[model samples]
Target chain A: MSKLSARSEDYLKAILRLQDQKKVVRVKDLAQLLGVRSPTVVGVVSGLKEGGLVDQEHYGYISLTPEGKVVAETLLQNEELLRTFFEEVLNLDSGEATQNACNVEHFITPRCRERLVSFIRFLEICGRGAPKWLDHFRHFSLTGEPPPCDRCGEIFPGDRRGCEKA
Target chain B: MSKLSARSEDYLKAILRLQDQKKVVRVKDLAQLLGVRSPTVVGVVSGLKEGGLVDQEHYGYISLTPEGKVVAETLLQNEELLRTFFEEVLNLDSGEATQNACNVEHFITPRCRERLVSFIRFLEICGRGAPKWLDHFRHFSLTGEPPPCDRCGEIFPGDRRGCEKA
Candidate 1:
């Protein structure tokens, strides 16, 4: 995570997307995708090349190095996971999920994501055994009242009950 | 998407997490949870209050307004979905899935997420009825080549060949 900035990750992801579509990507293509100037793309690409994350041929085309592909794949996988989560469990509109996934992907820690995944699996299993799980979730939505405490199994009424032992 | 910065969203999310535990969140607690100075929490709380996203008492205890609760719930739901996709479908390590989910939650589009969710459902169905579908997918692990194009019904060989139609 410390190795790349959000901007650099975007650049790598853009390159990966373009490379998937075509044999190579150009600076202009990256500029268009990133909404940045060609010079900015060039600088980023140069930085990527120096970092051994990308390979460029005569400035005409760009591609990810094997290492770069690994990072890109990691990012892509994360993006897909976020997309699935928003669509399936929360029932948010799809366009909103995509937009949110794009924004949230840069800041998550590995450990937090793992716990979230486990929670999701728990939901999926619950969903499979009882379609009413979603209904139950909806019935007990986290709104004016707080949902049951995950750790203590106590339901707090209204919006602001102080839990001394939470 | 432009309505909130990632940092702001994070604050909202942190607030929501604390709400889940304590029902009522205090500025000092938020500052500690967020690893920021109390002044920073104060500033964000003020902004949230102005935006009608939170209700704060004179003592600095805070809880989300209805609108704020909705936003936080939505964000949390997205995070959960991403976690599911990365952990279950992609078989990523839980930590990686969670980290990825945090980043991916903000970018996923509703349409893409719907397709992904339906696809996951379809895969589950296929897994139950036709083990071959699951087997085939398993055969094409990340280390292996990309699987056959669903449209062309032909296995892609290497990177350059059999991908033109894909």
Candidate 2:
């Protein structure tokens, strides 16, 4: 885990995504997805095979080994979790959140990942499958005002504050 | 931003932290901080100088240029934000969260960073400078149980679910 480079992790995750998309992951497919040359993909695939994380036949489809499946699935789950966090919790655009989530999946430590999973569960099951503040945030984003009035505890449109004397 | 590698970002951040610690950043200091050899640091420092990111006197102290200062400060702030999110928001240990924050700072895009900053601010000011769920989570962790009985909202130890018919 410590020795894996970000590049390799990206490659692995890319392969997993391509597979999910019903694409047979070949060197050319990897190259297109990763924006690298086919030769580079071939080299990295060879390295992945040597590490026993991937299995490839001669000029054939690339597939994850059993051990590789565990790693790839965990990475995919991490990316999905982060994407949800960014898009649902943070109110980011879907496309931008997905891209950022992919990059973040490689760097997050296991402990942080566990904490996030628990937090996400807590958020989902706590009341209405979302926090109260999340609704307030959505309102604030649309109105460019604070969530409710601080003094009166009422949602406002930024112009009316009941307690102006304070 | 797209052209920068994770390694170079790490080097820039290391220099910034060392500088903040009031240490004279020479090639040797960078090498020690980065766990790389001195010659590797020298090579990267030369590249940084060529890019006008760092200014180095001949065999003397290394310092960031204005452009470099901006980049380094942004990275440091991103790291700090993430650390706070993990530690304050997620209740992770300080040392582990700080280390994870360092790795996360490099991969987060500007858009995501902005969202995170806003989210952290929201968490800080939402109710009592922390979300209501955070207290529930702390209690849950201490007792190794869910936050209160589902039916009555009463805190309980594990195995004490009041609703057995559901």
Model number with the top DockQ? 2
What docking class should model 1 receive? incorrect
Could you tell me which residue pairs clash in candidate 2?
Answer: none
* lDDT measured at residue A117 in model 2 versus the true structure, 0 to 100: 76
TM-scores for candidates 1 onward, in order: 0.50, 0.83
What lDDT tens digits, residue by residue, belong to model 2 across residues A29-65? 8898899999899998888888888899997999888
Candidate 2 segments whose C-alpha is farther than 4 A from its true place: A1-3, A129-131, A141-144, A149-166, B1-3, B129-131, B141-146, B149-166
Show the lowest summed lDDT stretch of 10 residues, model 2 chain A.
A151-160
Q: Write the per-residue lDDT of candidate 1 for residues A145-166, one digit (tens) a residue.
A: 2233331212111112243333
In candidate 2, how many Å is residue A31 off?
A: 1.8
Sequence-dependent TM-score of model 1: 0.50
lDDT of 1 at A5: 88
